[model samples]
Target: MDMEQSRQKRSFAPRALPHEEYFAPGHRGCQGCGPALAFRHILKALGPNTVVAEATGCGEIISSPYPQSSWRVPWIHTAFENTAATAAGIEVAYKVLMRKGRIPEERINVVAMAGDGGTGDIGLQALSGALERGHDFIYVCYDNEAYMNTGMQRSGLTPFGAFTTTSPAGKVSKGQSTWKKDVPAIAAAHHIPYVATACISYMSDLYRKILRAAEARGPAYLHVLAPCPTGWRYPSEKTIEIGRMAVRSGVFNLYEIVDGKKRLTVKVRERLPVSEYIKAQGRFRHLTDEDIAYIQRRVYEEYEALLAEAAQI
Candidate 1:
């Protein structure tokens, strides 16, 4: 369906999002920070019984400082490379406590959150270990594409031809020389019970996926595409719009893998040209016609491949 039709048909929730807030106000997130919005929704869906283990990234810095915190639920800050490991430990500890009757026998959700750098680059080993070990928790990678908290450095998950402090578009190179890392596929390779891709632009789908992930028995992985206004060189107010464009142009997609089966959650029947998405951001300003075409070709190929994979289910 068309974008307007999709919008009209959207049902964000059977009811409105919870009136209660688990992520408190007074946090110092940037204007139109996608990750910050993501955190709010995450807590709202998981509720007060959830505990979050956040890595040292944008999400950590924005919500927690030495003397202050924005989280109403239990939250812990871990190193950039050990968020998942720490969350796994927490899950084990909670299980042990409940079994020993030291704590009430109640369900408590455990979640690990990190940025793209922490997930795909610095924290890959720890994350892989946790998933392979079958930890009963959720791992969330809020991908803004680059290391936005660290001055827009190129990261493993950064899209090809996207400009960053390290990957500048110049005479020698167009931008990042490599394609974005397929972290979701890497997570699914472990045969996790649930793996999903989401974007903040589609709140209904995102919320639904998070709830499903929380309900999964074993480990669950969610890769959320969070657009960065600062790092992506877009107007702060356009963060959600840029994200929507990314999905509609096939630059990003929404899908989920359940028990080794793949399915498309939000299908775009008529995708706009990739240029529509590219031109909205300054990061791709230096891209030439050839460069854009190359990027578009890759997007089309990957999206088509995703469709084929989902069709098998």
Candidate 2:
């Protein structure tokens, strides 16, 4: 056999795959949508005994269309700003049913899923309420940084200097000027049982976190950085690549908080310039050199603060 042929054969070796299914094929997600990939991985970790309460966002629209659905498990499409509230109610109902011998405790795991705009912006109040009440459920935010379902509008989680339809660049200013919200930290502040940040590019890491969160006793939150090719103006194939670059550039990090202690799970092994990630997306095309430098400084500052918090544990 030739050397090239042997190399190709080695690359195609079989590997262990996750044994689970939730989001099925034939959905309406955009090509290479990171959130779609995330949903698949998370459900694999969660297994079949799960019920999802989704908000009125991309996940709901893409997964559940009239006359057909992509979600195999029991799922509910709630209002835009009430996913967390609805999930909390589901958790309460499950406990009540279990106590009354009407439902088996091992038969279902309740989860709430929403986009960044829904969780970080519109539904934040309900999320806070659920955490404070100590509900036994998992809330997953597939954060693409903006409201992509509504024509790429700016959300509170959107990063500085990124162009959205609402925060369009003009003569007076570049794109969105405000920094992205620190959602994981906010979730940690609630002193929930578990809180973590994940990315679609790191499938194993994301899956492990979801599994851990599912087994916890009290409320848990998982914030996933799901890239959007259509909204970010990048090629469909670049979803995973850009998701990895976001973490490597320090713009995003993988970490968890348990019992009020912060822990950094994945560090930037070989740091890359933020521009490499930004320039690849059309949203940041109008950013000047000064703007890029400002973003870099912010990333470093945020990372240092995270390190300090994690060290205290």
True-vs-predicted CA distance for residue 256, candidate 1, Å: 0.3
Model 2, range 1-313, lDDT digits (tens) per residue? 3322322332211132344467898889999999999888777667678899999999988888888999888999869998989999998998898999997656467999999999999999998999889999999999999999988999999999999999999999899989999888788889998999999998767866876787678899999999999999999999999999999998999998878777988888788899999999999999999999999888888888888878888
* lDDT tens digits, residue span 116-192, model 1: 99999999999999999999999999999999998999999999999999999988889998999999999999999
Candidate 2 Cα errors over 4 Å, as ranges: 1-16
TM-scores for all candidates? 0.95, 0.94
Full-model lDDT, candidate 2: 0.87
Q: Kindly provide the TM-score of model 2 when superposed on the true structure, using C-alpha atoms.
A: 0.94
TM-score of 1: 0.95
Tell me the spans in candidate 1 whose CA falls farther than 4 Å from its real position.
Answer: 1-14
Worst 10 residues of 2 by lDDT: 6-15
